[model samples]
Target: MGRRAVFDDPALRLANNLLDVGRADLHRRIVAALHDSPLEESYVGDVQDQLAAVVTDQRVAERDRREASRLIGIGDDLLAAIGRSGTVLMVWRRSPQQVDHPGQNMPLARYESDGIYQGSWGDIETFESSPELRTLAEALNWAQRRAPHVIVRPWWNDDTHYWAGDGPPPDGMDALPDHHR
Candidate 1:
């Protein structure tokens, strides 16, 4: 009939680290100690770290309120899911590919597989066709039609040395074979 301990509170209402105890009595005693002890003062830096952790975790638990921390809304969980850590992602608002005046929306290409991405048939048929590049072009055209003014690059602003015949597509796209070559 007694209220749940702060650590066991299902809603995770407490901001402090949860207590660790192997036995119920030990757990109760620890909680009681915390309850009885004077409040501990922490440095601003330590509190900032704690606040960041709580805010990050809070953003993870809440959907709509999880933005403004990053421009792309590409939060920590999304990066960790992809094996990226300790780095920030910059998402551009506009694309430059539209400058080429290419007419079509990007047709979701595998980037490496010449496998067809038909939105209708799929990569398997596209591979069988051996006209994978053509299919990708068609997809790009399709995407252009949908988002005419859109640029198609990893990031929106910086002109990749790509089309200029200078260099590559930038990081993370190394998996994609050098189509230009």
Candidate 2:
């Protein structure tokens, strides 16, 4: 089995489906879909190149790579859910440069409600020093214990990024669900 960490996150259930289908079949379907896709031919060639570099098989490597792209694209709905519900506490708007290991990536979104996409915003933040973040947080709060702090920072967990929340902020920002340590 892969050594990937198993999270309690339900937002990624659809993406997890990719792992269920075997490698060969997934590649076959993905390549066919890409061929029929209305996007540019260069895009298809790029995808094919990526698969060729990573996948051992020549016939369907492009197919598998395309499948991975589909998995990630459809999975964005999960990210949007996290942002809408504020469960994605502090996160980078860009991918981290420190991908020392294979599968390392910026924090994915998670639902605080009924497992799947159904979730509530917990603590949201935009890229550092946003002009409208404060008002957004206030409007979202449902007359509870003052609004939480949406730690507005660049690169959520990057070396330059550092944010820590204590549940709901005394003034505003609250702890984000995806906040690491």
Candidate 3:
């Protein structure tokens, strides 16, 4: 498949980007060429093996190992989503900041639909809901129950500042429509 096709497929692109591989090992020498190849079944298996090795190598950086392990989980989730017939609900969160003390394990809802929507908050960690939760409402409800201390917002918006919370949005802010609830 061409680069466009690879980019169009979220699962494939994510696998390639996490694996950080290219058409051949030679391309690895050039940082820019990394993740330029399509993700094949064999490549996915190899990448999983490589990530597993990273996770088990004591000499590797602790952060790298943790990241590898997280990527493995994401890869597994992506594969499962691809195999299933329904939509996959993913929750993501940004690290807490001074003004925004969202507490521990709080999810950050994006104002946009893109899966990798990182605004001023910086990099965010993604969490995939159980496959059984097929809709956004289910995901939001799950998040609300799982982290009641924190506020949750809709996965996407329609240019308006709509948000979802245990109660109606405070004062001036707007709550999500009835259907979204």
TM-score against native, each model? 0.15, 0.20, 0.27
Which candidate, 1 or 3, has the higher TM-score? 3
Model 3 segments more than 4 A misplaced: 1-35, 79-181
Better of 2 and 3 by TM-score: 3
Clashes of each: 15, 13, 0
lDDT of 3 by residue, 1-181 (tens): 2212222233334334444533222123222322434333344445555566657767545765676676566556443323312222234323334445555544454433333221111011222233323455655554444332223333464245454545456676676677766
Q: Rank the candidates by lDDT, best first.
A: 3, 2, 1
Please rank every candidate by TM-score, starting with the best.
3, 2, 1
TM-score of 2: 0.20
Q: 92-140 in candidate 1: lDDT tens per residue? A: 1222234344676644433334233222111221111111233334544
Best by TM-score: 3
Worst lDDT run of 10 residues, candidate 3, spans 117-126
Candidate 3 achieves a global lDDT of 0.41
Rate residue 159 of model 2 by lDDT.
38
